[model samples]
Target: MARPHDAPSARELVAAVREFLERDVLGGLEGRARFHGLVAVNVLGMVERELDLGPAHERAHAERLAALGFDGDAALAAALREGRLDDRFAEVKAALEDAVRDKLAVADPSRAG
Candidate 1:
């Protein structure tokens, strides 16, 4: 039988991850450290998915959005032209937001470095 929904529920994962990132991981670290780590992990899982999909998906989306007359080509050209980002916490987020806003996937090139 074809299953429409077989994946683990987001609610469950969110609750579990939140609890873990907050309680378990935060238990030892200081406030700022804990919060940074928490955000990092939360972001990591989400970013990992996009990274895994990578090029094939990017091309597919670029093709579709171009067909729909969106500026996907422009965005992609920008991405290709965009240089490597500096290694910083804020830079990571800035990159992600930029890619997302441009309707392109942003994969963390460096995961938990």
Candidate 2:
């Protein structure tokens, strides 16, 4: 996970772009262009959060699924749909909620509450 480079890591680079878009690009636009710039900023924010948390989130998700006797998300979905997790519904629900929150944290943490 280590980058063999010097200063200005990938996260820093993304953050710089997002900041530019927010401070410069958004200020010069109007109507649709402004909307598009806002969307771009949101996308960049998601990308930044993903870069920061994706690996850890995936590890936690896999661990949670395995603890419930599933190999991965697909397997977990199958079991849920087939009622295979009926006995552990509460536990599964909690795990799923946590996973969703983790994703929302990356997609838009402000709405996570």
In terms of lDDT, model 1 sits at 0.56
Give the worst 10-residue stretch by lDDT in candidate 1: 104-113
**How do the predictions measure up, each by TM-score?**
0.36, 0.92
Following a full C-alpha superposition, what root-mean-square deviation does model 2 have from the true structure? 1.4
Colliding residue pairs in candidate 1: none
What C-alpha lDDT values do all the predictions have? 0.56, 0.91
User: What TM-score, to 2 decimals, does candidate 2 have?
Assistant: 0.92
* Per-residue C-alpha lDDT of model 1 across residues 24-111, encoded as one tens digit per residue: 8877887889789877776765555554555666776555545433565565445445643233436445544544643433444343
Q: Give Cα distance to truth, residue 61, candidate 2, Å.
A: 0.6
Candidate 2 lDDT trough over 10 residues, lowest sum? 104-113
Off by over 4 Å in 2: none
Model 1 backbone overlap count: 0
Query: What's the residue-level lDDT of 38 in candidate 1?
Result: 70
